[model samples]
Target chain A: MNKEVLKALERDARTTPEQIATQTGISMEEVEKTIEKAERDRVIVKYKTIVNWERLGEEQVQALIEVKIQPQRNVGFDAIAERIYRFPEVRSVYLVSGTYDLAVFVVGKTMQEAAAFVWQKLATLESVQGTVTHFLLKRYKEDGEILEGGGEKGRRQPLTL
Target chain B: MSPRPGLNSKRARSLISKRVEGISPSGIRKFFDILSTMEGAISLGVGEPDFVTPWHVSEAGIYSIEKGYTMYTSNKGLLELRQELTRYLYTRYGVEYDPETELLVTVGVSEGLDLAMRSIINPKDEVLSPDPTYVSYGPCTVLAEGVFIPIPTTVENDFKVKAADIEKRITPRTKAILLGYPNNPTGAVMERNELAEVAEVARRHDLLVVSDEIYDRLVYGVKHTCFASLPEMKERTVLLGGFSKAYAMTGWRVGYAAARHEIIEAMTKVHQYTMLCAPIVAQMAATEALRAGDAVVKEMVADYDRRRRVMLKGLNDIGLACFEPKGAFYCFPSVKVTGLSSEEFAEQLLVEEKVAVVPGSAFGECGEGYVRCCYATALSDIEEALRRMGRFVERHS
Candidate 1:
C-alpha cells in the first residue's frame, strides 16, 4: 500500500486514491488507507483546481467581507465564523483585530449573487452585527502568478485533441 | 562610533533590494518569461489584438514625418487633433469636453493612469476599483502611495459592479473611483444606464472618477457608455483613452486624457515633468486616427466579434462553462472539473500539452479555479487551442 501511494504521488499529486489503485495494481481499500495516513501525517496539505474563469465569462470578483460578530457566551467569534464557513461560497475566513472581527472571502456567480450572499446569507447571521464588503476592482496576481505580463506568454493556447 | 568597521557596513538597506522588493514584477510577465524559455509552447495569454496597425494610420504618421511636422506641438497636443477628439467623443459615446482645456496627450493609457494617480493620490488616500480588473490599477495606486480599495465583480452577473456594492465600500478616505469599461480579463461593459447609476454614487460621495475607455470601440452588441458623459460625472471624471487597442497602434504609445480644466492642469503638471508630451509623429498619426480611423475600427470590431463568437461556441461545446463577454477579446472559463488550482492546470498544460494559458489566480485571489484565454489569435489558432484544452481536460479527468 505504501509503495502504491508513493507511485501515485510520483505520477501526479493531483491524482486521486481510486485512480492510484487502478494504475499501481493495488486494491482501492489499501490505497484509501494509505492516503488517509499520508494526509494525517501531513504529506498532502491540500487539493485545488485551476480554472479558466475568463473562458466561462466568470469574472473573479473578490471582496474582503469584514464581519463584526456578537461573541457568544462560551463559543466566541471563532465558533460563529466556523459555522458561517460551512457554506461552500465561503473560501477563506480569518480572525482580525481592529474595526472588524473577521475577514471572510466569498465567491458568487455574479456581482448580484455576491451581494446577495453577503446581504441575505452572511449578513443575516444572528451573531452578526455589521458587515463591510470591499470588492476587488482588478487582480494583478493571485497565489503568486501574474495576469497580463504581455506577448505570447500572456496568450492562452488552445487545447490539442 | 568610527572605530568599528564591521558594525556600520551600510546595513544593505534592510535586506531585499528595492528593485526586487516593492516592485512585484508583473505576474503575467513572469509567466511569459517562463514560456519564452520553454520549448513547444503555444500561448493565447496576450491581452491586445494580434492585428498590425492599420495601413492608413501608419501612413498618417509617416506623412507627418515627411512633411517635417516632427517638432513638439502644444502641451495639450495639436488643436486640430483635440477638436477632432472632441468631435469623436461626442459622436461615439455622447461625451463632451473642451478639448483645449480638458485634454492632454500622453505616451499611452498607461501614462495617463500613472499621471492620474500621481496627481490625485495623497498618501494613504483610498482609490476604489473593481477586482479581476486590468492589472495596472492597484500597483499604480500603491506606487503613488495611495491605498487601493478593490471591489470584486464575479462571473455570475457578467462582472458588473453594482452601485450598492460601490456605496458600501466607500469611506472617509475614499477620494476616487477608477472605472474601466469594455474591461480587461472579464470583457464586461457598462451600458448607459449602469454608468448613470455609478455616476449618481460618485456625485453623492464627491468622488473623482477615472474612466478608462481604451476598449471602447471593441464592444460587440452593447453600446459603450462614458461615465463623464452622464450629467454630473463630467465635472468629477477623468477620461483615459488611447489608440492602442482600437487602432492597433500599441507600439506607438499614444493616448489621451480628458477632464475638468483643474484636474487636467494637475495631470499636465505631472505629465510635463515626467513625459513632456506624446510622440510628435504618433500624435499626427492619432489625429488621422480620430478622423478616418472609424472605418478601420469598425472593420476590426467586426472581425473580433466573429472570432469572439467562434471561441465562445467552441468553449461551451468543449464542456467548459463560459460567460458571454460583451467587450474586449478575452474568455474567462471555470476549470473546476480537473480539480487543479489555476496555476497547476496552467503549468501542466504548458509542460505536458504544450498549450499555454494564464492561471486565473494570476489576475487576483478570486481568480482561482479559472484561466483567461484571449481570442486575439487567429480563428485557426483559437480552434486548435480549444481542442488541446479539451484533451488536457480529458487527460486530467
Candidate 2:
C-alpha cells in the first residue's frame, strides 16, 4: 500500500513528490510511483481543495437523509442506493446498518431544493418505506480541518519575555 | 518635571557586573523591537516548535495534580522520572546511568547547561566550544566565571566543530569542551565518527565534555550520537537532554542531566541551592512522555521533515545558498549575495517584506553572512515567506 507515501499525501495533498520522499524516507521516484498507483487504483479518489465557502458568503444547504427501503430479491438495498445516489443533488451515499438501510448526503442551494430531493426523488422510489432529513446548521470542523481556528485568529504578540 | 520615574532613573548603571556588561545584547533584539509594532508579520525567529505539548502528556500532568501529587519532589526529582530517564538513555543511546546516583532532573536543558558549567569550571579556566553555537553557551560560561574559547567553523565544513580546530585552541587551563548538536542556529549535526574523533581528543587532553542534546529528537535524515556513549567518554561526559524540543514541552520547564556520579552530584548540589528541582507536575508529565509519547515525537518529526524539505528547496530555488541542514528546525541561508550584513538583511526583510528572521551573526561573528530562518512555521506561511523573500532578494540583488 505504500502507507507512508499515502500518509504524507493524505496529511497534505499539496506536498510535492520531493517532500514526500523526505518525509517517508523514500526516493522521489518511489513516491511518484506509489501515488500514481494509488490514483489509478482509486485508493486516492481525487485531490480537491477544501475551501472555506462561508468566507465567500456562498452558504450551502446540506442534509443527511436516512432512508429505509424494502430489500429486493436480487439486489438488497444496493439497487435503491444507486437510484438515490445518481441524482445530481445527492452528494454522497452510504449503506448504513441499524435503524436505516442507507444514509444519503444531499446538498443544494436552498432548504426547499434540499427537501424536495427527499420528497420528489427519494421518497417516491419503489419500496422506499420511510425517510428522515436532518439539516446541517454549522460546520465547526470539516475533513479533519478545524473551521473555527481560522476566524478571528489573532496573531501572537510579536516579541515577549 | 523632575527626572521621570523609569526613563530617567540612572543611578545604578555601573552596579551591573563587568562580566555581564561585556556581553553584547542579542543582535536580534533590535529586529524584535521593530517587529512588535508591525501587524500581520510572519516570524521565523522563534527557536522552538509551533506545536503545543501533546494532549496525552498534558492529561497525565492534570491527572497527577488530581491525585494530590503536587508537593515539592525530592531535590533530585521524582525517582520514577529518573528511572524513566535511565531506561530512555540506555535504550536510545546504548549508555547506562544509575537512576539513584547518576541522573539529576533540573529545570530545563538551559539550567542543565548553567549548572554543568558552574559546577566544573573554576575561575579563569578556558572551555573550548563552537564559535556559532547556541546563544546560551557563551553567556552561561561567563556567568560561571569561565573563559570561553570559540573555535570557528565555516559553511564549507557544514558548520561542525572539527576535532582539529578544537584541539589546536586547547591550552593548559582548558577544562572542558561544551557543544550542542542538532545545533540551534545552523542546524548542524556531528556524525558518530566525526564526534568519535573529538572524543579521542578529549581523552588525550583529559577534559570533560558537556553535551547539550536538547534537540536530540529533532534530527532529520541523521542519527544523533550521544557523546557519553562513545568509548571511554561516559565517565567524563555530562549529557543534557529535555522534553522541550522532543515532546513540545518547553513551557513545562523540565530537563535532566546524566553523568558520572561525581559530575551529577556536583550539578545536583548547584541545582539544590539555586533551582531546587524541576516542577513536580512537569516531572510527572515528562515521565509520561518518556513512557508513551515516542509515537507523538515521531509524528512531529515527520511533519517537520516535510516542512524542512519545502523551506530548503524554496529558499535554494530563490537563490539563497543553504547547505543542507540535517538536524533541528532552522535553515541558515547565506544572505551575503544581497551585499548586506546578517543584521541588516533581517532588519530590512522585517521592514519591507514583513517576514521576521534572526540574523545568524547573533550566534557568533562567523555567522555574519547568514540569516537563521526557522521552519517551525506553517507550510503555507513558509511558502508565502519564500515568495516575499524572493522579491526582497531580487530587489536587493
Candidate 3:
C-alpha cells in the first residue's frame, strides 16, 4: 500500500509529515516519499474549509448581474467580461448568447452596497455598455439537491420476478 | 454589422431573455422535473403536506363560487378574510391587529415574502436570517436586491438563533431580521424566552422582524411564540402565516401577512401591480380552513409525530446522529460516519436503494454532511426509507 496516499487521506493536507505518519499507521520516511510524489502528480490539491459564512456574521448575498458590453475593434467581448470579473466582489462569471452578453454572480453586505459596487466598480469599467441585475427571488434548493420534501417514507423494491 | 440569416456564425447567439439568464430556478422543483421524466419513480421531494384539503374547506370554496364571489376582492384581499386572520392571530398567539388596517392576504406565504422584500429592499439591503432555514428567504433577498445574512444554528443549540450571533452580523446597512420558527430543515422551534431576546435586539436596533410562522399549527410540545406579541416588537414586525401547512391545502396557494398599516399598504400596492389578487377559490377555502380545520390539523400533526419518533429512533440506531424535530415534518440527521458528503450520500442512496432525500448543503453552505429527510410522507414509506438507509449505511461502511 502507498503509505503517503493513506497518510494524506487520513489527515487534512495541511497536517505535518510526522502527524500524518503517526495517524496513518505508516513510517515517516514513507509518508514524506509518497506525499512529495503525490503533490508533483497533482493527486492532492489545496486544503479548504466548508465555511459557514453565515456564522461569521457576513451577510451573504447572491444575485445574477447581467451585462452588455461593446468590445473594442481589436479586443472581443470576452476580453471585456474578463476585466469586469477580475474584481473580488464577482463570485462567478459566464458569457452566454442571450439578451445579456455576460452574467455575473455577485455578493455584498447590502443591496445598496452591491448596487454601488456594480455601478461604481463594474458599470464604469471600459467596454460595459449596459447592465440589468436580477435578484434571486427564492431558492428552494441549490448545489444539486432539494431543500424541502423529505418527511414521508415510501419503499421501492427493484422489480424482481 | 449584423450577420445575415443562415450565415455561418462565429459565436452562438442566445435566444433566452437577459432577465432569465443567471437566475437559478427553484431547487425544490428540480427533483419533480427529474421525477416526471423517469418512469416509476416514487418521489418525496415535494415541500407541501400530502393530505388533501379538508372537506368543509373545499365546500366553502364551492359555496363562495355558488354565491358569485368571483369578482376580484380589494387589492389587499377580502375584508372578511383579513378580519378572520386578525381574530386567528389574537386567538392563537395573543397578537392583535386591525384586519382592515394591518393585514393583507396574498397568494401564499411565498408571495407575502416576495412582496415584503420587493417593497422594502432597495438595491443592497442586508437581511439577517438563520441558516438551514426555509429555502425561499435567501433567494428572495437576492431577487429583491438585498443581501442574505444567514446565522448558522447548530444541532447542539437546537438550531435556535442566538441573540449574540445576531448582534455580531448587524451592520449599518442591515435593515431586517427574517425569523422562521418551527424551522424547515431542522424542525427546531424557538420558545417565548428565545423570541423575547431576539425582539429586544430588534427593538434596540430598530430593525424590522419578518416572522414566518407557516408551520405554527404543526408544532409539537413547544408553544409557538409570535414575535409581534412581544412589547415594542408589535410596531416593527411583519408576520407571515397561511392555511397551506395547517389545512393540507398546498395547491390552493393561500396565505396572508399581518403588519403595520403602512407596510401593508405598500405591500398591497406591489400586489396590485404584480398579482391582482390570490385565487378567489383558494381564498374561500382558506377562510373555511381558518373557521373549522382544527381537527384536520391535529390529525396530520399526530401522524407526523408518530413518524418522527420512528424515524428518529431508526436514525440513532443506524449510527446516524439526529435530533428530534420539534415542528414541521422533517428530520435532519448527520451522515458524517458514511465518509460521504451530504450530496454524495443522498445520490448514492437514491441510486443504490431507491430512496430520495435532500442534501443539507442545499439549504445553505453550513449544511454539509447533513441531509434533510422530510417526514410528511406516510408511515410505511418512513419505515422503508429507514430500512433502506440502514442497508445503505452498512454497505458503505
Best by DockQ: 2
Clashing pairs for predicted structure model 2, backbone only: none
The runs of at least 3 residues in candidate 1 whose Cα sits more than 4 Å from the true structure, single-residue gaps closed, are A1-161, B1-20
Per-residue error (Å), model 3, residue A31:
58
Per-residue lDDT over A9-82 for candidate 2, one digit per residue giving the tens place of the 0 to 100 score: 78878888976775456788988999999999999998889887888899699999999999999988788788
Highest-lDDT candidate: 2
- Candidate 2 stretches with Cα past 4 Å from truth are A1-9, A14-37, A49-140, A149-161, B1-8
Per-model TM against the reference? 0.68, 0.85, 0.68
DockQ winner between candidates 2 and 3: 2
Candidate 3, B155-180: lDDT as tens digits: 88888899989999999999999998
**Where is model 3 more than 4 Å wrong at Cα?**
A1-161, B1-22, B26-34, B37-42
Point out the worst 10-residue segment of candidate 1 chain A by lDDT.
Answer: A152-161
lDDT of 2 by residue, B1-397 (tens): 7977663345466777798888877666787888887887889888778887888898999999999988898989999999999999999999999999999999999999999999999999999889788888898898899999888999999999999999999899999999889888999999999999999999999999999999999998789899999999999999999998899888899999999999889998999998888899999999999989489999899888888988888889898999989998999999989999998898899999999998888888888999899998788899899999999999999
- Model 3 vs. true fold: TM: 0.68
Clashes of 1: 72
lDDT of 1 at B39: 72
RMSD of each: 28.3, 4.3, 29.9
Sort every candidate by lDDT, greatest first: 2, 1, 3
